[model samples]
Target: MAKKVVPEAERRRRRPTRTGTVLSEGIIVDTALRMLREHGSGGLTARRLGAALGADPSTLYRYFAGMDDLTRAIGDELMGRALAGWRPTGDWRTDLRSLGLAVHASYLAHPQAAVLTASRVTGRPREIAVDETILGILRGAGLSDPAAVHAYHAFIDQSLAFAALDAGSLALTDEARAVDEEMWQSTYALLPAETHPHIAATAHLLARRMPHSAYPAVLEMLLDHVATRIGGGGGGEETPHG
Candidate 1:
């Protein structure tokens, strides 16, 4: 006897419901990420996400305890993307430069999300792994435990701080961004020559510099400071010097 074959649509309709427990957390996070990228932090409420996903808001609770929990998960997702396939090259400067640029690029790609979540310390697995990688880099550079820890703190803090700040600045609407440019060109550029001689001298250069132009240079300056402190040149013999 020939067995009846279910139609594809019928099969889909009759398929057993996904155990909520095993439902794709990744999908949830991805949706949240998209919401963040499109709407900024304020637009990421559970109800909106639920509507977007065709799931009840309560369904989100099964995956995350609350919006804060979900936000942290989103942060972890971003970190995972930033660090994916990242392997240290054993050159501290190059490794750090790569890491900083990767992070900045990742955050810039999701500026609203970055602005919302950059300061959060979720201690999620991926975040912990990033911290470990950074600490290892500093330690491999021959920094003492205390110095390595300090440098790790400074490096991570500065990276995230700048990434968030830069992302926020980039997220401004075209009109708002144009206004900022206008202020710099018209108002800031016109500072009194005698009272703000240094500012006056660099106003044109500053106005011409795009936001991205300074990130690499800023990262280099920070790394240079870290290297100086690690190389025994900054303070005393305990410090490392280039």
Candidate 2:
């Protein structure tokens, strides 16, 4: 795959699409992202991407070896967006919280693409940079090497896991998603108090609130746990917003 790296001059010469549109990695990734949003994961095909770019399907091969490569590239693009202009404020917990939210927001913004790419290990520039940044933050917070590694694993995994789950719900069709929401309102919210007391009591609140993503709350919990373990007191309280 991507056997040879073409020189910049050659790449520039081949940049023009069949319709005289200029093509580059950014254009292809952006088009793919739009396709994923408009048409869902199934709608993103090489043929469709080519058509959207007004280029021959084969033209995409110059940039991406195949669809999977393109998918990983899209994932990396999300990571890049999340980390863009984000700087750690030297307070480890605050920085970690900010990082989690940024990553979560990026995925939620493109649910369809998130569903395809969240769990993947892209190892691309942005993905690797994110991993390094998380580890650095954890270690900077006074976690020993082993402990920092453990926390890094937990934090990153939890973030991506929740992103994928929430994105799956967002990617549901209008009819299907409505059914889920209706179930929360009509079925769960109206359960008999005699058998399911908790559901009956909190049903109103649950219906009102459960639609939001739980990633932010979960991330806060993880961060709090890690902070507590390392005796990182007075790290500023964080109110998680999903």
Clash count per candidate: 7, 0
Q: What is the C-alpha RMSD of each candidate to the true structure, in Å?
A: 8.9, 5.1
TM-score of 1: 0.83
lDDT of 1: 0.77
Task: Give the candidate number with the greatest lDDT.
Answer: 2
lDDT of each: 0.77, 0.85
Report the lDDT of model 1 for residue 43. 88
lDDT of 2 at 145: 74
Off by over 4 Å in 2: 1-10, 232-242
Clashing pairs in 1: 230-240, 231-239, 231-240, 231-241, 232-239, 232-240, 232-241
Error of 2 at 205 (Å): 2.5
TM-scores for candidates 1 onward, in order: 0.83, 0.88
